[model samples]
Target: MIICELKNNQRTDALVSELVDIWEDSVRATHSFLTHADIETIKLYVPHAIKAVPHLFVARENTGSIHGFLGISGQKIEMLFIATQYRGHGLGKKLIQETMSLYPITDVVVNEQNQQAIGFYEHMGFEVYDRSAIDEHGGTFPILFMRKP
Candidate 1:
């Protein structure tokens, strides 16, 4: 598998659709608090965000099929999603490593209810510095603000 940056023209409509599929599948596996309706609503905005994010990267196999992706806005990780089947692999770690090499990333936020994600970020050397009562979408699910220590 190869981890590489995605160029503008490389993000075709079909590729966005494939990335959305991965995003929804990963969210379904990890974000149990979200309803199907919520997923549908979030999916509506995914395409726009994919195009607007300043830095976007993907992990693909030898066949050039993307299995996971990371999106960054400046130094913060705006989004990172790995296909359910690809979670246990080091793809996520590799994505983070690649992003850090390119940007001075020090802050990230994770759904506080998602223990697995919190643990993963903590294991990755980030510490929770603060907490919010609601998520950015104004949802009840709280978020933990973390930064590298």
Candidate 2:
């Protein structure tokens, strides 16, 4: 698979919808801490967040269909999600490496309840430097602030 920057093409609308699906599927698989209500609530903000992201990239097959995406703002990775079937294939590491090549990514925040994600970030060379009792939006879920040395 090849990774490429997501451009606003004629298929932008359809692609955005697909990306949201990937996001939901990924969250459902790993975020066992979330209730149905919590998932629905967070879904409300994802589309808007996707639209507001300044930089976005996708991992695609030779057929050019996207299987995962990453969004970054400056040096922070605001979002990253792989289609459920694409996880554990090192595509996420590829995306991070590509993004880091383009930006000085020094930090990331992960939900403490999402152990899989926390482990993945740790494996990718980040270490927890701080903790918050609540998420960035003041939600009840705790968060871990990690940085790469």
Candidate 1 residue-wise lDDT, 50-131, digit = tens: 8778888999999988999999887799999999999988888999998899889999999998898898888889999999
Predict model 2's lDDT versus the native.
Answer: 0.89
Q: Pick the candidate with the highest lDDT.
A: 1
Candidate 1 worst ten-residue window by lDDT: 1-10
TM-score of each candidate structure, all chains considered together: 0.96, 0.95
The predictions' CA RMSDs to the true structure, in order, are 1.0, 1.4
lDDT tens digits, residue span 52-136, model 2: 7888888999997788999988777889999899899999999999988988998888999999988999999999999999999
For each candidate, the alpha-carbon lDDT, in order, equals 0.91, 0.89
